[model samples]
Target: MVALRGRVWDSGVMQNGALSELFGRMADVMEILAEDRFRVNTYRKVARIIADTPVDIGELLESGRLAEVPGIGKSSLAKIEQFVHTGRIEAHEALLRRIPAGLLELLRIPSMGPKSVKAVYEALGVTGMADLKAALESGAVAELPGFGRKKTDQLLKGIAFLEKATGRIRLDQAAEAAQIVGAFLAEIGQVKAIVPAGSLRRRCETIGDVDILVTVDEADVPRDEGRRTMDERRGAAGMGTGRMPVLRAGETLATHKGRTPSAQEAVIEAFTAAPFVDEVLASGPTKGSARIRTVEALVQVDVRVVAAGSFGAACQYFTGSKAHNVALRELAVKAGLKLNEYGLFDGEKPVAAAEEADIYKALGLDYIDPRLREDRGEIEAARNHTLPAPVSLKDIRGDLHMHTTASDGEDAIEEMAQAARRLGYRFICITDHSQSSAIANGLSARRLARQVKAIRTLNEKSRDLTILAGVELDILADGRLDFDDAVLADLDYVTASIHSGMAGDREKLTTRMLKAMDSRYVNCISHPTGRLINERGAMDLDMEQVVRHAARTHTALEVNANPWRLDLKDTHCRMAVEAGAMLAIGTDAHSAAGLTLMAYGVDTAARGWATKKDLLNGMTVRQLQVFVNKKR
Candidate 1:
């Protein structure tokens, strides 16, 4: 499918994400046109499959492993093959032609679905945001058959939110885009190294764009035997052996021999020419930039070709929080040195140009990790030689919250346990929703009792892992939990949350949360702020008070790992830990695949400078039991 912007790959190279996007875009367009519901759903499902597939589509196709995936029949296989070979889906192009391209933009509005967009289009001739805004302002949309005043107001609010939203995308989206673009660039035989720079390297929750620094193996015609060997391997593997025409060891590099592009130019060409790229923003001998299409978003990726000697310097300069860089430069100025993307120099005599640690050591400071380079007290700590080690995924001993088929989860309890065990987790808690959360197929008291027995029975049979019975009990607006304390007494863990009545004022919401924490059975709070990134704003709770109350009550606050809701966000995580409250990292996984989301939570915790001591996920099973038992 062709978007208004992005180039289709003519190189015949394809990634799973690109194929997923094509099918997803087709599904979206078909929905807008009110195409066959079954076909639309089928396309959407396949899109998800492609996006979630562990291997690249090209690799899968080459290995003939496509048939292993259920639901992909001959027609779907044909489309996948067609897109792989020709970079276009004929049916997708036909559907795009049937609708105004701007209609797709309308679907991006929060709460705006295809049906709503179709209604507005049919009734008020709304083709895009500008047209829709006019119709809403004139009360024409409110008067539509199904849209009343409330719906119109929501649409207007959504539009305002969309307008206010930053162009930056979530961290996962940027990372995925970087992987796809980086892979494409790596295909070039001359490309030697690719390192992600900027906010992406810093592990920020969102990224404005992707910046990558690269080094190409440059050599003269009597090419080094190693370079020749690599080229031979590339050719043997069916990848073309294309070499750049110039070579240099230091800063004075590129000397063009005829029209053949230099090594840097070749890399830039391949980068901007990738099929996943939507638009080429800029191209040069040393740098190239383009907006690339990933399954999740259209992300702009910039690539800079630098000498191997300057690669580290380039990384430090580009992988920056401007404030941190400014602080480092000030130190450089005071020390009679100069620092830039080229190198850290003492009066133009290169002092440190190689590794990041070398630059820090020359400046008389410890190397600050990219995650700690946010200019948030890390610089001072690094200088003082007191930087605390940040928490890592390996430190997580267990996932404290999850669900199973007894609730809304996709997998059975045993299956969920096996997935956690495979990750080397010592323990996991099955925190299914309480009865009040009817929409989630929440379990009743009797059901919970039965689940608790099933978990105990399972735990008895297992020696390597422990499964704890838990409930994500709802906190009513009036400050009572979905279940009484008597019901909670039967469970090994309890996480209280406000799922409904979140519209209450700050004082009211804060009071309800505090009251819930008062329960001895409550050991943690899940998705503490209830914020769905980009879609919903955080609930207005006085988090300062909540943190203090949690610390006092010994209730750990959760840093939910779900990308959409990294609730108890980085900032909140810092605040909570500073206030003496512990954090619990949980994928809040509904499916076995969801268990991997813990990486996002761990990164967020690290960004906040959390150590293993401040997170309950790092606690041993026995220690965790002691913790919850102490609450009782």
Candidate 2:
């Protein structure tokens, strides 16, 4: 029976293109073998591409073309072909049997790696946490080479702490913390500028700590005006105009006049010494920092001060992906100089000390935008000088799709419109959910008409922004649109999307989406694949075909900004952009706070290398109005 079940599963996987299943099995095997994280990640990435690929995996394997896929090279292609030919992956199976399965879970503990897991297993016969703790109490862990009493205690504490604490906090959490600290620092008269740096600035999925850089002038300093007169004079002269002077050295003097030389020092002191901080580290007058344990995660806070003129460049340098900074350094080397947190130098001589943009310009490239500096082909792109024009928050003139009180949204038409106008948006389309989404107060014809009337009234009263009545019409089970053509046409902008009956045959899903796209009044498609991050999987559909249809029909696809969704993700956005499909970055905002999520949508768009030309919101107010009129 087991053999028969295995055969059935293999046949089904072969038929449906379960490349991820095979690759995931292989990754599990690699984990058992204690393979490096990067190698494991490569296999996983390759698996994802294969699972998402439209073509049959068997056909690709037979064609000897698997290496053509990104992140999959000769080594991976061989493994894939081996799995395709023989139902067994030998290396993975061997590793699986040799390594205890439970050890894989142990590796997930913070600061614990495969080597440590293996060590515990071998030394104490501890394959799980319960056994490991017994070994720790028995002093077996301390007896191991390099595992001293101190290290053992820390590991035990880490195990206990991580068991109760969340493993990693997302980047958004760090951003929130930074905003709080920034507001506090802003109130200080000495602070000239404060900007977040480090992984938080790079928008990494998780951050180790928060680094805030600040600039300040001597006049802004509060106390000890006369005693430290020489230090102030040096700060003024060495700081250079517009640049915050980096203090070489200073002494602690309590004059009570608020004579802080470095803004970074001030911010570091303020946050580290705050009531929220559970522990303080190395508090000094010049460069004190600390770690604060919040309910969500532990945040390491650091502050650095530089001359005012170089603050922007310094912030950019410090907030870098080390790999990106290294690439920039190499570029500087080729130009006969060195680059650092301060600024660029020519043969140990300060040549140009201005902003980050100026530094990039001096490197003989168009200013490399900070957001694009993720070290992923950006260096080559910069060298080839092919970087797209940086898309700004200002380039967005309106949100093409949003929700309101008519649906799940907290705000009414007038309130949402007023909020949009306050944020400098010229227009907003209220796209309430169709009747299928009854939970969101999905609108029927009569309710939709009432909402339209309210929007029209708001438009009449508002001079700065226009409010367009819209509907997020659902794609029903029968591959047909939720609302009839008559109802769709009554609205100013129509965004048709799939809500229910998400899982289905790929061809059926594709047909359903195509049918919606074919509608004359359908202006855009929301979320496109209906994926919720780390939760529900995307609906099975031909994404390339969907993008092509959207382009042909002049229907835009939305990159939903809600954190949980960022759907029509970066890769899909790039594909849609390449297909000439106009893309819209919408908050799909259910509340006024949701509007601010436009940045996340924009980030996803930029990650996809999208430029203003590729976005529907990039259009001028007049152009967008004309487009809406055309849809009508």
Candidate 3:
């Protein structure tokens, strides 16, 4: 029987199967060649369909159903069958030979794609990391088609970081590091203002590293002798004595010392001399900016000195989006002037001095606020600017929503109140989770009373900040508050929210929300939609009806500042503002650091064009108390 059995199918059939595999591989090769993502995706789609078809592709071809598969047309099918018959694809092989294999890897670079990589490789013979490094070292990369030294340095640094730690560090982690550095600098007494800028300031989902810029007093510069002594004695005994001598008023030192050194000069020198800096990018006698390459990302620190009056303007100019600044420059150009990181200029000459207000005046516009400086029609609005007076961080007198150990917060009531007082806030409400959500250690009725009593005890000790006992009561499926009116009436503020049954029908959800709004003690709705960004969908609700009801009842809507849940998103905020419903921006901080998230919320509010009048929290401490008392 074995002898009788002979190969029924010829080698052509095997070749046909091999040709299909080759076509699939060729499609991938062509995709990488063209860098046309949409077309590449289409080919990948066809390949996947052919691979996953129920019937054998060979049999399907025999049955003349190859084109019947989705994403596969007659042309594609012909190519597939041809590849199956032939050992190679002539065109694909030719492209493979022409394109350096290393160029394909460059496409993975962030902020750069295939087109840019191809351009770079063709112009500079830079096909991969090895070639790129050699070219950069030889100054060849900088001399390439569109790249300068800045771009070359950036590319090299980026490649190094990518090869080391490729993924972005968590935003919270980056903030933690910035906070540590900020606290250290703040303790130096001479430091006036220290701020974290760049991607962190923009509140990106992830950050590469942290950037902190500090302003110091001009009178704090160390004398040359003092610096030399400190440098020489750094590892020797009496180093501490050297530091003390710099501060001492010795007659010998006074007579010999030159004119007092500039504080700005000293700061510049200190930063350049720091061991943390890998290289000094630029420096000036009185002002300088340098980029420090850290394991995470490049940290750019710029230092400048101006009259105290002009400090705010400098800060605004330095902290910017290039696009936003470019738009400002274009506006200046149209008005027969120029704009730069320093200030507005009249044809390369300083016109309005270093004052931001003067610059705005020179542009024939009301001072375009820095918070609204995202180039989102801000320039146009400035020309005919009827910009709504924005709500400032100072105007926020109270935070109505917060958590404590009763739920997930790390700080106790007293600790949080002290932190809030340091920030000049007038009042804060402790709104812990209600009983339904046991996972968060939701408070039972007895525990709520105990927590309220604790808040009262802390309130008596709180010197400037008022403490409001509140509860973030969870709304049940039937639209009932977690606590009854008796318990709710005992609290200063109540923020009702939906945490479960998110997938409920629209009518049920709307009814649930409406019933909670009817409660006399409920002051606002917290994160109405219950979305967690890319995770869950927002609960269905009749938003128009909900807005109307909130307006009718004088209930406020909360714009939660939690990064993961920027609920009451810009669109919803605009609608709420139009509906005459006041908005509350709360950081929902679990720790002291979380309070800083208020800036993000404020940015979001600005994007929605919310004015001070539209924000319930944008009031003085006394005014906030009056509002709460009136509600009571």
Candidate 4:
């Protein structure tokens, strides 16, 4: 009993992410050791289930709810209970002990699965990346069974891709790092404000490094006095908002550089000494760069201390797409002004130094959101006052896709509904998997009918929320949906998707996708491209044809909001919108915490120039019903 209490204390602090990773690593090690394939897949499945679960395992265990989840069998349950009580899975540790720890790193390379690694280890005695790379280059790996010229070539390419992608991190990972680091820096008394800049500010899908801009507290600095200061300074200088006297070509403007020399050192020192920081890359009076540790990876974060007057200018300059900044500077030059991080100026006189909007207005352009500063016709649109109003999180009235305990989800239908209601959603659809996905414990016809009845019962009781019974039906390899129209007609919404046979012929896959959309019962297609960022490339399919068919059928294409699978990416979203197809920003949330991922989907749509009207989720509950009903 004493050991149990001690174990529970340790387990309580282990977050879901850490637990997921632990199981995932265990599976990798098991595969490397040539463990039973069924056992390995079970471990992988449990890892996925845990990762999708937002709630703490200890809490679930305390409530005796963990055992209720499907896909977790007796043995798996034992392992989980062991983990919960002892904060360790001895089975996983035992598997890890059988192989060289470095062998796990080999799995990071694409196309290097456990079976392949096992073969290489046995044949070539390759246990690490360096040894494998040497073997591939020397053409020895090609001589191995099942690895010929073609596969070897792919492995070599994977190695090169891995090398190029090494230091870069995903946007979601960088955001988490920034949040933690920002919280850490906010503790410093000398710090006045913090703002994330660089590609992060622009919301790039992948970030090379993170840049943070801070305003140091100074004696003379005006806090939140940007507009007032701008008006006072411009009026006192006898300058009008209209065009200032044009400076001659090659004439430079003296910029008002705001650097509090007294406070810079203190802020920089505090930033470098942050707890999350792994190594101090560079430190100075105004700038400090460090590699900060995160649950995902070690990311380089550069913090810059700037004066209040130049804060807006610094934000505009550093939160840049290099091409967009270059184009903006060209426009500034044409207007007889000098633009830089310090501020926008006209021949030694500061014009718009305190506000980004003022800087754009002075340049005769509308304010461009940072997300649209990719030089992808946004500047031209701003000049013409024709930029589309991008979709916002508030515009999402409902979530059209999600799972429940009826399938492989960690939460119950009512649980998901309550969570969505808390997020101010007017409606939500319960989209458990159809009967084809045995692995997910997909509902049978009888089970689905019962769930439909249950949803209707819940809908009657839900005064402010509309609950739609839906099924994420599988599109079989032969281009037929897993459930017939008879089974699908009972549901309020249906999301069709390809879960297998993605490696088929391009023409066939395209045909399969088009056929799925033609069904009157199909309301949308989820993760149309079927991709997992950084892990799997998109399946081969004629997307143009898919989009065209979707538009003709009025089928909404989902912008699946899972960070790992932000499918129907920005470019694809734009293409689909241009083709006249609507988008559905579904969190594909397996758990309640997954519901918050709607923001990432919204961000992706905004980046694609999607307006609120372009999204199905952006519609009122009644409007959404009309849309899906029309398809039926």
* Candidates ranked by lDDT: 1, 4, 2, 3
Cα lDDT tens digits for candidate 3, 288-319: 45555322234554445444444544555655
On lDDT, the candidate that comes out on top is 1
Candidate 4, residues 40-77: lDDT per residue as tens digits?
Answer: 88888888787766567768878989889887788877
lDDT of each model, Cα atoms only? 0.81, 0.69, 0.64, 0.79
TM-score of each: 0.87, 0.62, 0.53, 0.75
Candidate 3: regions farther than 4 A off? 1-318, 405-426, 450-466, 477-480, 501-515, 529-549, 561-575, 589-612, 619-632
C-alpha lDDT of candidate 3 relative to the true structure = 0.64
The candidate, 1 or 4, that scores higher on TM-score is: 1
Best by TM-score: 1
Q: Is candidate 2 or candidate 4 better by TM-score?
A: 4
True-vs-predicted CA distance for residue 52, candidate 2, Å: 41
Alpha-carbon deviation at 632 in model 4, angstroms: 1.9
Across 477-556, the per-residue lDDT of candidate 1 in tens digits comes to 79998998899998889998889877789999899999999999999999988977776778999999999999999999
- What is the lDDT, from 0 to 100, of the residue 579 in candidate 3? 91
lDDT of 2 by residue, 317-413 (tens): 8878888899888988888898887778887777566576778778877766666677877778776889887566778988877888778876667
- The superposed Cα distance between candidate 2 and the true structure at residue 365, in angstroms, equals 1.3
Model 2's number of clashes is 15
